[model samples]
Target: MEAEYLRHGVPLADYQLTKADHRRQREAVQVHEWVQRQLAEAPPWSDERWEEMRQLLGSPTPPWELQRWQLRLYCGHVIEATRNRNSPRPDGGVCDKKRCPDCGLDPAVIVAFEPLGPAAEPPAESHSLRSSRSTRQPPADRRSKAELVAENNALRAELEVLRDQA
Candidate 1:
């Protein structure tokens, strides 16, 4: 349900959610904007960077997932109301009721997060380049994060040089 909202980008009022859901969706939108800004300015240096950024931030899922996850966490509990519109309450914790097969809510719930945890995005990714075992190219994953940044800068310089040459 939340995914449909996040994926669609339609206004929250379209979802027919209860008042609490509307508030939660609004909060999610804020989170979504912040996450997008982070994504745009993240390391600016690798395919794996966004994943790493996400790990530092909190979620590997899309902005909407985190938004919905946060909403569910906040709602704690929501009761079945008219026409499948669930009325979530701040108290009582609807987590148990969340188990219904048709409900489709997040399975596990977490409270807090640590700063420098595991890699948000794994290193095994291609940065717009096809993966090849060429000796001229070493996988960016093998290089330290510092090395990758330096390499990126060098590549940018080389690109400028090529453009001037052309």
Candidate 2:
């Protein structure tokens, strides 16, 4: 039987009675074709562009996108203040005294930092699990497994009857 099974390449599962095992198989030829397609479509990153990005980052190390977004916000405020002549600069260039030059506003004006801070820490795995647990409905409060099973059976019977009537 084993020799015949190997010789015919018959799946063993067909001979056995069991629950479904869902698994996907891909051809080697198809995998090779996908690799070729990916290589052809993807563009290589240039060293010059990388260097420019590093300079924009202000340090050799690059900060995360969130930090970059925060810095962008600050720079935008600084740009707006300077353009409007409201920047707090002693020479009226922008606030040199850490306050708005025109309006004497401190927090209202933006101050540019020479170096942007490092990126915030990535969220912990536990936090996500906890959040998901909190958001989900708890298991039904009904008493006894027998009662729940009875209820489920009743519902199924009702559904089957409705389908037959329809």
Top TM-score hit: 1
User: What's the alpha carbon RMSD for model 1?
Assistant: 19.5
Estimate TM-scores for all models.
0.22, 0.18
Model 1, TM vs. native? 0.22
For 83-161, candidate 2 gives per-residue lDDT tens digits of 1112122123423223334454332322222222224433576557767887997577856889889999999999999
Where does candidate 1 clash, by residue pair?
51-121, 76-93, 76-94, 77-94
- The CA lDDT at 15 in model 1 is 32
Q: Which stretches of candidate 1 lie over 4 Å from their true place?
A: 1-16, 47-166
Span of 10 residues, lowest total lDDT, candidate 1:
110-119
Clashes of each: 4, 9
List the global CA lDDT of all models.
0.38, 0.38
lDDT of 1 by residue, 1-166 (tens): 2112111112322333356555654565566568789989876667688678778888433321122221222223322211111212211233222322334433312111111112132244442233443435665569788988999999999999999999
